[model samples]
Target: MFRKLIYIVISALLLFSCGGNGDGGKTKLVFKVGKVAGQSGYLAQIVEEFENENPGVDVVLEILPSITDQQHQFYITSLEGGSSDFDVFALDVIWVPEFALAGWLESLEGKFTDEQLANFLPGPLKADTYNGELYAVPWYVDGGVLYYREDLLQKYNVKPPDTFAGLKQAARKIMKGEDNSKLAGFIWQGKQYEGLVCSALEFIEGNCAGILDDGGNPVINSERAIEALAFMKQLIDDGIAPEYVTTTDEEATRHSFGNGNVIFMRNWPYAYNIFNTEGSKVKDKVAVKTMPHFEGCESASTLGGWQLGINKFSKHKDWAWKFIEFMSRYETQKKMALNVGLKPSRKDVYSDEDLVKQQPFMAELLNTLLQAVPRPVSPYYPQISLVLQAKFSEVLSGSSSAEQALNEAQTRLTEIINRRK
Candidate 1:
């Protein structure tokens, strides 16, 4: 069931490579794209077209429902084992350190021409590189966005808040004056997933807490962080945000917001097209803008997206790189962004005539993405995020105080990193 419902389902093929290169060394490239079930359609078609464009290369794209961090753990197990069958990989931005540390990815500095590197956005360029080596190329980008019910806010004579305190006050006012019991004030991804890391990072960066002293060990339990988490908790316990938000991921939160049950939603750009569509109850009433900010910090969003990396064990390094390059092209990115509203990783796509016409939020989306902060880089980031997710989930659910949760998370993360180091 997990195989069928998740992204593109390609069962891990067991292979014992006791042999040498075959057929006069004609490489067979197998591209494994992170699949998200039905969301694999666009990339699948693009892969077919890419294959048609390059005849000699035999390319197979595996769509994995890799949006979840659990899926990342699943693949890391295989890749670390030197699985040659899976050539190209779709990876999360946070995974660069883990993948690069294991030496599972090919260094693309000498691989791709300077002209090609010049075409990518600086955010992805920096994200794909680890230490001093360039590894994966970002395929698509998604940054946090602030979505609100335009009509509802206007009906209450409220304008979109520009700062964190302003937003909380606005949410409180909206909740009390309106039928707030039936409407959540603000909705965020608070569950124990990679998304929680994204949301928490936004809070962290927006609060001026990027003070990692080395080894990327963040001062997560600092006063600013504690205050941010408290504000988040107050939003829930004080009735501005719903209590159920502790368990809600992007889908649940989006579903609630799309039904007009929430006045403000902090989510990725994907929700822009989804929540504003005709089928959604929020149609014509929903609008999006940049995420709000704190006192000193301007509006900051967690900058992250997915990257496509070639496995060092792949039999088709040459062809796989070619396929990676094919997908990384501006044209292909624009098509994917327009097709499913997956924001493009390229800086150039934001101004595309077609894209601008279809998605008017592109301007602010571009700004947010440029300003999006990548999570702290470390080989054990997954472990670090795990500790935070568990504790933050508890904090959101009111099972623990924000200070208690951050302290616990910080302690656990420190232990995990120390043991690894």
Candidate 2:
């Protein structure tokens, strides 16, 4: 009995010394990667596939919040605290400059060869670079598009709108003719979040005014920008867009459109696949087009997507890079694009004959993706975006006029940029 007791005690000591069961019989290194919801299954399968070939590595996934703003905050806190909990993470395109500048992400300049870097789409690839250093790999591409009810347009005898003015007229005409109380003429995310910044950028870009000048100075108070914000406010005030939109996020917009409550919606490409899925009420009645523009300007979409990055504090950066490289390959990209409707980062993936056949919209999206405009690339991007979101929300809620809100935003952004200097 004494001998058995001694053996048990030794075993317990050994287990405690080695940090519990994880180090007891470990033959593999376990690492974690994180992303937002809805891609858990697909991402897990991809990691499992990588594990099969690696044999001595385990890739675990950490699911993040669906709200982009919350997700951004989560990353900021995690990475800034030097937490090694997430060795790899998916980053929104606009976060590249901020995270890289803060030294939270690993510089990937020599990790990928010139030929490999050439495979990604130019806009997304450019977004991964900060001060000439590559810090992330483009995982996918996203840009806003307008989704309208084809049946309703035909029923109302109105053509697809080519300009914002035309879109408003069409929406008003359709809503008045239908006389349905539950149906809203148009819908979009108006919440004070990252999505609101993206939506606001689209409006500003479409109006031929952007958030920054060519030299990266704040231009949020331009005449065209105020006009764009006014248009957004007018839409809500005129009853063409619902008042509850001020509380809406991406999922809310999707749910509203999927339930056939919205006549038109402006959202990312992912919404296209969702709305046409089997259970959607708007299936077969939805058609997508690029966002409408003002009279002189061409249509514009705020470039969006996610990137794969290695944490600067991670011990398993080599393995993390291996996982990133694996997912960035043409075959894996094609699989994800075809299976889950994720837009591929690789330029050639969109031109794949098989993919285009399965998703006819790819052919149309190529031009849109090519011309997509990136948001202001700055180390102070987070602050700048917050100012824009707050000011835009003020305009939408009628708490401030477009000119006043934009002027406030401009003042805040200038202070932020100058402080960084």
Candidate 3:
């Protein structure tokens, strides 16, 4: 009798542990999602809120490496291997086309309503779509903004520049008036990496036109493109920009600007809060605006941000969509914006009275974001970017002239585009 009673108790415990719902007789669903460590805090909060609102589900947050490249590689390897471990993926803005073309992501066209689709900014929405099909939903948006030293501008009696020529003039004047050897006129991402591609796109687009025509043909070897790249080389050649800029990435430029050593910087919105926070040398002395353009051209910013997509191999795609929808709502976006300095992808959120009052810079940021342009939306984008990056870096390092580099880039890109076809 004692052995029988023990067996019965063990059996009861096993039954209880098997996820049985006592009241409704339905087992709870467990959904797994992944994000980098930088976004994990707000994501955890969203997950907790989601779990509270839906008592029948559990969200498992799989934290990935903070480094963007490492995280990207991990996702590519896992997804390519047909792993179903993660139901949803937080993807880089540029990865949508690659993943969608590879069929690693589910087409999200019908998952979103027309009204919902209209809320997102056009540039970000453009990034989430591939070949006329939606593969992801924009979670946040980013664009390059010009950050300047307000106090220095005032001291030098200079106004903010609207044109690239004016910016160069202002930077030179400030550097001279300050008379500090430690000061540099401007800094930006010039390193020979993916960042160089983004920087080059801004310059190429701002000077005249983007690298590709509307028909998706390679037009990177145009005179306007040569002039654009020449301007980049001229900055380094003319001593207006430091020689070390060739090695500088976003964080390096940020540190130089934050330490009050740079008069101007081109960086994303993420740098705004850090520049104004306590302990920064330029705290309260920094101002941001749209990037400068050529005299006759309108300013163009490179669109960048992150989006969420459901993995094609996931079994819990329905619940995965639910989590994505929850996180993409207006309230959720506003909350994340206010708490974590994330730029919202929605046009409506930019006009929120309370958010505007709290984040005054969002007013300028919204203007910049509206004018932002996405990089080429193609699965061959990585190879294309590599070609441009290599050629542009050559120009900056003085190993190749602007025209020579762009011509080479054009040839390489055509080969890549045609080979993929």
Candidate 4:
């Protein structure tokens, strides 16, 4: 309650401060927009363009924290308190269901025609909808992919693996041939966080299983899930992946791979440009492919990215939506893609001539993006993920067997879902 009250006060002040005059001393309608910080500043540039195009509406961009958990908690506090300090904001893909269910996001059902929505990648579009209502619009997208040292693979005469078993075999061969005691076979985001849940989902679904079935009941303790978890455990125990992976996240794995210490890595699309940058050790030697799958299962990359939505409490719903519409435009998304290497949520942007020429990898990723899978879609997902993280950490850290950890997770998830009912 105290936190909520404090957020309310902060929001009220923000509202008053942002609702001020334009730079030219002309009165204009101001709409505040909040999004995670550390972007390429293309957003600020786009905001300037929007102001020039709209004339009479000023948009203020509030840069939020980069940490996902901190951003989630900040939104919960402000939205739960009915604060309209920001008229529009960005939401992580997984937050759409929870935010919409809480009545925090405005319904955009009829705002976009079916054809416009169709232009976006199916995975992100599905994630932005809740209970058949469009609650947000995809701005940019991300999906996990496998990064490997292409030169090393060629030198070792190893084909990029399409299945987990093949990946293990190829990794072992490369490790043996390289003869670098400092090098590890593979690395991934295994720390106990949302990234861990995404990594675990890829492994589980690669084995043709899921955390929840079609009816939304927990199915995380199935034989396939146990097999997947056991495979991950074996990666650590057998020294195929280092024990330190259990403590690392996306950036850590990227750095380890960029430093030329790992044979393979599972990470999102954003790391591609960074790896090719001048100072990176693996520059020009890296290539990406769809994440490896189990023997009979198809490859799966976890669907991730941010969406733009209007605050239900905003006084400027129409204007907030205009800003969203602008941001989702092909030109805006293209600029973002070319400038920062952010994967475009719009399918057409991937085929843009300049984008294909500059970032050909993105064009190649279209097929993989189409097959990407989302984590369970539920308002209770945050709580469910928390349970999975703890249990998964236990399994990965060797404190519990895969079966024991998953069974405990299943029990805890059941309790969480049932209590919500």
Ranking by lDDT: 4, 3, 2, 1
Per-residue CA lDDT of model 2 for 236-325, tens digit only, reads 999999999899988899999899989889898998888788988988999888888999998888889989888898888888888888
What 10-residue stretch in candidate 1 is worst by lDDT? 9-18
Of 1 and 2, the candidate ahead on TM-score is 2
Q: Which of 2 and 3 is the better model by TM-score?
A: 3
Tens-digit lDDT track of model 1 for 64-139: 6656556687677888687887888888888887888888888777777777677777777777788878999888
Q: Which candidate comes out best when scored by TM-score?
A: 4
The TM-score of predicted model 4 comes to: 0.93
| Model 3 C-alpha lDDT per residue in residues 25-75, reported as the tens digit of each score | 322334434443256687789778988887767777777665667778888
Clashing pairs in 2: none
Q: TM-scores of all models? A: 0.89, 0.90, 0.92, 0.93
RMSD to the hidden true structure, all candidates:
6.4, 3.5, 4.4, 6.0
Local error of candidate 1 at 110, Å?
Answer: 3.1
Candidate 1 — what's its lDDT?
A: 0.79
Give the per-residue Cα lDDT of candidate 2 at 71: 83
Q: For model 1, which pairs clash?
A: 7-35, 7-36, 7-37, 8-63, 35-63, 35-64, 303-372, 303-373
